[model samples]
Target: MSAQVIAIDAMGGDFGPRSIVQASLACLSATPSLHLTLVGQPSLLEELLSGQSAADRARLTIMPASEVVTMDEKPAQALRGKPDSSMRVALELLRDGKAQACVSAGNTGALMALSRFVLKTLPGIDRPAMVAAIPTQKGYCQLLDLGANVDCSAEHLLQFAVMGSVAAQTLGIARPRVALLNIGTEDIKGNQQVKLAATLLQAARGIHYVGFVEGDGLYRGEADVVVCDGFVGNILLKSSEGLAAMIAARIEALFRKNLASRAVGALALPLMKRLQADLAPARHNGASFLGLQGIVVKSHGSAGVQGFQSAISRALIEIQENLPERLHGRLGDLLS
Candidate 1:
């Protein structure tokens, strides 16, 4: 097999090439077979790489491009006008077969728009969806349509269920239980769209559809695959992020209340580590934009060095696992 390479949109995140460059070095050190091509302004990317050892610098190739698509720029305007933007250039590398996957922490709308416009979707997949692996009590849960298609149809949700199930399985879950998100567990719950989606999932072949799952059911380990339109999924993801931060802050406050509490906190260091590990977004840093011709991992824009490193490793795993090939094989007929 050919060596798997990833094209990173170096100019695309809150920290830009600094984080991406640090991540590229970490990923290369961890996996020898993977190569990285950083797409951004040569001068800036080179500056980030300047301090690295010569051997480390040899592993990366910088592709110079001046333009950058801002988080606030509309996708259409960026795509049409800024042809050399890092985001667009990264996707182009994937399209041209120079990279196995593309990763960006840029504007979600621009990434999705550029990808769909350039790579298109697999047949029978009406709309591509954003899928993220969120930490759960039991393990990881794959949540789909996280801000891709806000206004979705029943068919779209069904497709998301299928994609999410496949993704969860790829992550080591066997026969992942799929759940449609709704207001309640009753068969009659949810709006017309969700009700219809639940029905479709139940009737869909090759998946373990477990009926509707409420938002509150996520931490309870109700399902391995959770399906919802992007609007709801986005809201749920952001809310969970906020909640996790709040919980961590509360834990810190409690630990600082008194000497007794500080002693107890010291005693619970191991437990705290486990809890922190479970909630770390870096563990689940990669989220595949499903239905695209190739794998595209989108990390959070504000991801730090560790998170960016995790994103690179996750992308390498996707490449090594032949994620796109497996998806194409399993969903080929359905997509056709």
Candidate 2:
């Protein structure tokens, strides 16, 4: 196995360092070739790992970071006010080539701002967009511009499609079918931005542009990659998350309604559990900040150990794929 290093912003999330440390340890144990650097308050990190065996921690290291980026903090404040923040330090490690990628369950806006500031966008790219694997009926679809660029140009939407295509390929789709998320599937349906992006995508090379896909089509896995402006994508993702939770809750409530219902639920419990797991949004937690010069994955801020571990796994996949390098190589063909 090839050696791979990933830096973790241990202090950035809602649950803080404890969950990050646990996820790091779980990932370390699972990936023998993985080396992790936890960037946070050294004391807390050390204490977190104090109970683990030497064998478990053989490839782990702690990098000191005195500050943490709060969930509600403004992006600009996190950028300038906290130079030594765990999020910034973790990105610095990736920038300096100390790690193959960086994983953070950090404030999304702050993560985007700090990453753009520290790593800069790749040549030929205006800004980086966040892409995540959203679960679909057939499997999963790669959705992009997840809260990074709320306002985007037609050109920016084209760029997101290309980036999302690359990410979809990394996740094992050889020729990812890229689509622009629109109000309707018809050519005449969307705003000027959607129409312009569709024209660009249809003409673009190095991607399989399948034209427009609506929200329902997206959930049905009609396309491998779905591109949208951050405003729409973020709302879609959050609403999907909320809907999943509500459905699961309603099912559970149905089961608990009466003893007869509870008995029936007991008989169906295993299948329901599987379905719940499949529907849980946090089951797919990491979103890559595509178009960055380095690999940076943003995890859900409230992710627990399992969710954060999935984020780490996402980073591992990107590292192995050398995603940023691939994006740089393919940009000219897709963007030109």
Candidate 3:
């Protein structure tokens, strides 16, 4: 089999090129069949890559980009003003078929806008939704519209369900139990949009519509795929992350409260580390902009080396599974 090539926007995120370069080298070392093209200012990228072994360096290439899309930049302004930004350049590589997929920790709005403009949406998809894997009691659940489309119609919600189901299947879930996010599990709950979407989902050909799931039900693993509008999904994701961080912080504080606590902490350090690893946002940093013609994974803007590496790994998996192609085929039947 041929090597899989991925383009990375090295100039993006809070840590800039260093974290991205570090992750790239690590990924290349771990996956012998992986080739990476790091896109950013050539000088800075070269400086960061200076310490790598020649063999490791050989598996990577640098693509120069003069501009960068800042975290606060407006999506429209960034698209028009920064044509040569690292984010845009990376997407171009995918557009031109030079790379199988692209990964970026840039401005989410700008990334989505540039991706749609460059790669376009799939045939039956009117808009792309941000989908991610969220840790749940039974393992994880795939959730969608996580801040991509703030306002969506019933049709849009139905589309998100189809796309989310396909994504779950790609990740090894067969005939995923799909559900609509709402205030209650009752069929009579939710507003017009969600209720209408529920009806459409039940009538949809391929999916296994499992009715509604409340906010608390998400972590309980009530469904394998959960669909919601971007407005609700974003708040849910952020709130969950914030709650996890607070719990982790409180645990650390309790452990350091006194001598006895400190001793106990030392004894329980291994268990704590394992729990922390399982709950770290870094482990789930990547979110796919589903319905795009090509694969694009968005890392959190403040992600570090390990977080960004997780994003790159996500793109690689989607590329290998040919997610776009599968989504396209499944969408035809679902939308029909």
Candidate 4:
């Protein structure tokens, strides 16, 4: 395969540029043929990498970005005001073919807006939706429209289902089981939009429609791709992350409450860590913007080095798989 290049918004996430810079250096060290272009204040990015060897710096590029869109900035405001923002510049690299993919941990709304404006959407796609992998007992499932479009019609949900199915397919599932996220699994338990979406999915060609899957069913790995509006999907994703953290903390607290428990905890610490790593949200950090003409991934704003690296890894995988091309090719058949 040819060498791969990815552009990163080094100033976008919650953590300072130090963490993003570390992750970028780590990725460069690990992948011999990979190149990174860090879009931010060139001087700060260079200073952060001042200690690196010349070889590492040779493969790295610092693209100057004068402004930054804050994590809480409104999408419209950022779009109108921050033309040279790190997030927008990184995406411009992808749009101009300077890089194969772009990754940003910036404001979700702004990233979505800029990506749509810069990269545009694939033909036949009304809007691009965000899809991220969520851990499941069977393995992992792809959930889409994660905080993209707050309100979606039945047709939009159907489009999300198709895009999500292609995502699963790119991950090597020949025929991914697709399902709609609903309060109840029964046909009669959801709102009209979901019910209508179900009807459309059932009739769509080349999709393995699996009917409705409740929220808990997601953890059970009942479906490979779950479709829902951005409002519900975002809430579900955040709630799941919060719940996992709480459960882990509770377990840790239980073990430290007494001497005997502490002794047992010491014995089980290795196993606990393995389990935690398996289900950690950081392990699946990047969320892809499907239906776009180019590859764009959104990392969690609060992600640390590991999470940010995982986001870059996501962009790598999509680049290798030619994700946007695959989605464009498959949309015609699936929706027809």
Per-residue alpha-carbon lDDT of model 2 for 1-336, expressed as tens digits? 689999999997788889889999999989999999999999888898899999998999999999999999999999989999999999999999999899999898999999999999988889899887777888888888878898999999988888888888877889988889999987789999989988888788778999899999998899999999999998988787677667767777888887678878877767655555544443446778999989998888877898899999988999999899999989977676
Residue-by-residue lDDT tens digits, candidate 4, 22-140: 99999999988899999999899888998999987878999999999998899999999989999999999999999999988888899999999999999889999998888788988
TM-score of every model versus the real structure? 0.93, 0.95, 0.95, 0.95
Angstrom error of the Cα, residue 296, model 3: value is 0.1
Q: How large an RMSD does model 2 have? A: 1.7
Q: For each predicted model, how many residue pairs clash, with residues at least 3 apart or on different chains?
A: 0, 0, 0, 0
Model 4 CA deviation exceeding 4 Å by range: 267-284
Runs of candidate 2 with Cα error greater than 4 angstroms are 266-283
Residue 83 in candidate 1, Cα distance off native in Å: 0.5
Deviation of model 1 at 325, angstroms: 2.5
Superior by lDDT: candidate 3 or candidate 4: 3
lDDT of 1 by residue, 39-130 (tens): 99998887888888888776688887789999888989988999889988889899999988998888888999999988888766878898
TM-score of decoy 1: 0.93
**What Cα-based lDDT does every candidate model obtain?**
0.82, 0.87, 0.89, 0.88
In lDDT terms, how accurate is model 2?
Answer: 0.87
Q: Give stretches of model 3 more than 4 Å off.
A: 266-283
Candidate 4 residue 47 Cα shift, in angstroms, is 0.8
- Winning model by lDDT: 3
TM-score of 2: 0.95
